[model samples]
Target: MSHGVKKRKLDKNAQESLYFDSYSDVTIHEEMIADRVRTSTYRAAILRNAEAIRGRVVLDVGAGTGVLSVFCAQAGAGRVYAVEACSIAEQAVKIVKQNQMEDRIEVIRGTVETIDLPESVDVIVSEWMGYALLHESMLGSVLFARDKWLKPGGLILPCRAELYVAPVSDPVVEERLNFWCTVRDQYGVDMSCMSDFAKRCILSGDIAVTPVTVEDVLSHPARIAELDLRSVTAEQLRSVRGEFACECFGSSAVNALCVWFTVTFPCEDNKTLVLSTSPFKPETHWKQAVLYLDEPTDVMQDTKVAGEIHMYPSEDSARHICIHVDYTIGEHKKHSKTFSIPDGYSEAQQ
Candidate 1:
């Protein structure tokens, strides 16, 4: 091989290594296991679709700790292949054995794309969501598995996913911006001038992973994107774009746009099980992703905030996400800004 090709390969490997290595930590697994809202929903969804899983081969992509694989075995799946690329897969092997399900569930340590399955899967189950739904781009792996190993008429748990965005009045941003003013009162320094710099620092195109309250919401959320896992393509995953228009509930300052997602599992008789990570819903480890506007927009009741949002992978690394917003509040001039997950922050940990 050539020197340039080797450098490119190393760069790609380094980026992927950083992502997989984070999952090796125990704290991340503890957080996901402790997220009742996430775990219970998957368990219920699997059991609810027992007919589809029972006596069928199953594949669990990005199977961290093999929890979902065990769930499949409980659902009477004939065989379950749990594919994980991180060091955590070793622990998953022990976990499966401890549960005395070693025979039914086989934990394989490798990316779904590279691993070879003995047979096609009848059902694919995975907890592939990230902050704002697409932050870590793990769905790409699910899609790869689905296309390569899923049998015809096979099922994908949480087959549908929807992304939502709402205008929010974040007091946290207000508090942070106001803190500069208080520096003179408490520390006897005229540091209020730093407020502008702080505003720029906070809103300078980096998405914030933080908790948002129901009361902080200024308007009803609009669905920005929907992914039908069965039909969604890898090319489509490159850029998920949608337009939204939300009317303000009451006069308030819209400091940021909060994004969340919900996935649905199809059950018997058209029933569906939904797992939501919304501020309006119970809190989860994957908190709301907030994009603070550089300049907060003031609005009256019923004012419309119309805009387009484009979410895609960053050029430097496919796992990293970039979000671009182009919006106009009421009759104000059009405004545009872009945001991204900060470097070194692993959305996979969420």
Candidate 2:
């Protein structure tokens, strides 16, 4: 038996947050399912290890449309609990029934932190990564589910996750900044002064979720941090800090630090299946997070760029994240900046 929330009306802000947090919109689920890299990776991870799933009980945390639960059912799971916190749970029930998995899968409409399962699960599967991997704060719920319902030595899908960072030259950002200055001549007005203000507005300490090409990379990416989900604690995730150093490929205007993540699933054969959202790999809905510098730095070949990255949950919204970066371009040049992932980007913008 699972405890569920009773029907209740919520205010506007509460409603908005629920929608954003739960991804209640069908279109959002459509986009996520349509992402070949993301969906295929999870499918492969589950189907490849059918032996482990057979006759096992599974729990799908934050199961929006119950897709992962369906995958586990198809993989021969005896029972699957699909937990969701918003209206999407109703749809998930329909999706499970439509797929003729109602007997094997149970859709529970409530937050995982509050929901109760009939028995402990042998496996916990979730796609909780947000923009830059921690923007949405849903990992906390997954961790809670793990502590409460996961069996001893139970498996977690994509057991390992790593964050990477590197320098990049974003011509698109430079052109946008320069456009603010060029408008002075086109409009026959002294608008060049607004360039400084425009730069601040555009780069106002928010993670830019944009696409970057491999050619735009100015240096080899460094692995900043790694999380073993099985042992990682929420307290440790509150302030994930890492140090990285990279050498510039050549003289280039390094305008931003590109950040991305990769997750790996351990197989029964001792092999690992990886799903990377790096610019060097196929793009997912997460694209890549670019933290633009207030002013671009020019670096020469062999120029060493070293930095420390600090990430934490935002004070205003737990679902949002704040990133602080301190870096040096050369022996004498040091700079530090703080950025955040805006609520809109995590919500409607996505």
Best by lDDT: 1
Query: Which 10-residue window of candidate 1 scores lowest in summed lDDT?
Result: 1-10
Question: How accurate locally, in lDDT, is each candidate?
Answer: 0.91, 0.87
lDDT by residue for model 2 (1-350), tens: 11385434455467446645557676788889999999999999998878898999999998998999999999999999999887888889999989999999999988886778889999999999988899874788888888999899999997989999999999988888888678768887767888887787787787998888999999999999999999999899899999999999999988899999999998888899999999999889889999998788899998898989999977665667889999988774689999987545645554
The regions of model 1 sitting more than 4 angstroms off are: 1-10, 347-350
Top-TM-score candidate index: 1
* Residue-level lDDT tens digits of model 1 in 210-293: 999999898899999999999999999999999999999998899899999999999986889899999999999899999999
Note the residue pairs that clash in candidate 1: none
